[model samples]
Target: MLLKGKTVMVTGGSSGIGQAIAIGAAREGADVAFSYWGSDEGALKTKEAILETGQKALAISGDVALPESAISFVQETVEVLGKVDVFVSNAGICPFHSFLDMPAEIFERTMRVNLHGAYYMVQAAANQMVAQKTGGSIIAISSISALVGGEYQTHYTPTKAGLLSLMQSTAIALGKHNIRCNAILPGTIETEINRDDLADASKRSYMEARTPLGRLGKPEDLVGPAVFLASDMSQYVTGASLLVDGGMFVNLQ
Candidate 1:
């Protein structure tokens, strides 16, 4: 129960990694509230999972790409879950497209959702923590793409790298208020977003073989790291990037 008595808020939590972290916090005895962008069924399932853990659950439907939406999501969470002890920025989209043939609209939307959305959400969450007068943790769901490259992620990688940079800068700005900021770099997690990409047998095997650990990651594999970042266990850790890639990043050969 590392998060006992704490209230955790998450964005893009209707499914995938975000949903896993939200429920993970609940399992650790924290009240969990999350923002989802119109995934009613997914949101309901996430809420049910959190409730089963005997912790409070709040499902907020809003677009993180809008600044006011992010602000209102925070306000609503505080009003319901009490106060935010930890905030996770996990809302993002990665629309795979060849660099040479990338559509301007697709690239722009990616920037708006992944990069701009995170900026707004993080700012809103930090402001609330400042008002609370208590130290808090902020975690961003950055990816290994921040360190490497992807052929179809030309428009996506930059945003993740931006997230890594965001944590570093915010760590300095928010440290005075005792607010800690960090990013998680996960590698090849099998989620809905990449299901089609990994569906090819050879592609999936190549990806798995690239990892020294011999497998791709599951959404739940990230829970422990997210919990660590959100809990006091990482009290002294800030402005850091935790790479949870199953040794893939090191298997350059």
Candidate 2:
């Protein structure tokens, strides 16, 4: 009951890490809402799960990459939930290609969603948190790619790296207002997005062998840290990143 009576929003909540964070919040006794740009079916399923946990849920449909969409989502969620106690900017895309040969559009689109979208969400949510004067938490789902450069992942790496800096800057500015901002850099979480990309045998084996944990990360593995960041458990913590990469960053081989 760490988050009892609190309200939270998770973008990309239909699946993957976003879905996991939303469910985790509900289980911790928080009212939840989440945004999904894709399938309504997945969003509906997540909604049902949230309801079963006895938490209210608002399944919003929108693209986080668009400023208007991000603003609209924040406005609508506040209308329904009264106030947002936590916001997790989890929506992103990673389509890898050689840096020299990558298409301009793909790179631009990735920057739009992964970096710009997060900026807007933080602005929207932070504004609300300031108005409420109740303080809140903001967690951005970053990646290990930001820390370690990898071949063919140039676009993704910079955006994820931007998230870490964004978290630090926001945490400093919002500290006096009692709003906390942090990033969770997870390594190789077992999500459909990654699954699709790992169809190549070489990529699959590389990630597995590189991770010291001897296994790929699960979406559920992020639950504890998400809850911690969203709850008072991290009240004294801000301007930091909790790297949940199972030693991926330290394996330097």
Candidate 3:
């Protein structure tokens, strides 16, 4: 039980990586709270799973792109779970679009949800941790897209890169307060968000072949790394980007 009696709040926990992390934290003995923009069924399932682990769970409705929603989400988590020891800024969107003729709305929406949303959520969570005067952990669900270029993700890549940058800067800013901020760069986890992109059998097989691990990632694969960051295991680690891509990023010649 790495986080016994502690509280964790994650954004976009209705499904995918976010939902997995939320449940993983609960299993480690932390009270889990997640803010979701959609999927009532997913939210209920997350809550139930957490409770089954004998930990408290809270499901909040929020759009991380909005500053107030971020604030409210953090506030409610504290109101219910007392204090936040770990905060996961995982709410994001990536609408794949070509760079040659990207729609302004898609680009704007992607940035707002991925980058701006992280900014607000991290700020709100950091403020709460600072006020608590207790050191905490902040994890951003960045992507391998941050470290590499994506032809169809010109708009999406920048937002992920922005999240990685945000973690680095925030780490420096919040280090004095003992708040550790880090980013996790997953290569290509099989999630609904990118199901369409990988639907092409050729694309899927190519991606699998490109990775040194010879397989795609799963949402559950991130649990261990996230737990390490959230617990005392990473007490002295901060401002770092942990690549959980199963060797995909390093396979390029």
- In lDDT terms, which candidate is top? 1
Instruction: Spell out the clash pairs found in candidate 2.
Output: none
Looking at model 1, residue 52 earns an lDDT score of 98
Per-residue lDDT of model 3, residues 81-103, tens digit only: 89989999998888888898999
Model 1 ranges with Cα > 4 A deviation:
none
Give the alpha-carbon lDDT of every model: 0.95, 0.92, 0.93
lDDT computed for candidate 1: 0.95
What tens-digit string does per-residue lDDT give for candidate 1 at 14-66? 99999999999999999999999978999999999999999999999998888
What are the candidates' C-alpha RMSDs?
0.6, 1.1, 0.7
Itemize residue pairs with steric clashes in candidate 1: none
Misplaced by over 4 Å in model 3 are none
> Lowest-scoring 10 consecutive residues by lDDT in candidate 1?
62-71
Give TM-scores for every candidate, taking all chains together and pairing residue i with residue i.
0.99, 0.97, 0.98
TM-score leaderboard ranking: 1, 3, 2
Q: Candidate 3's error at 23, in angstroms?
A: 0.2
| Candidate 2 weakest ten by summed lDDT | 191-200
The TM-score measured for candidate 2 stands at: 0.97
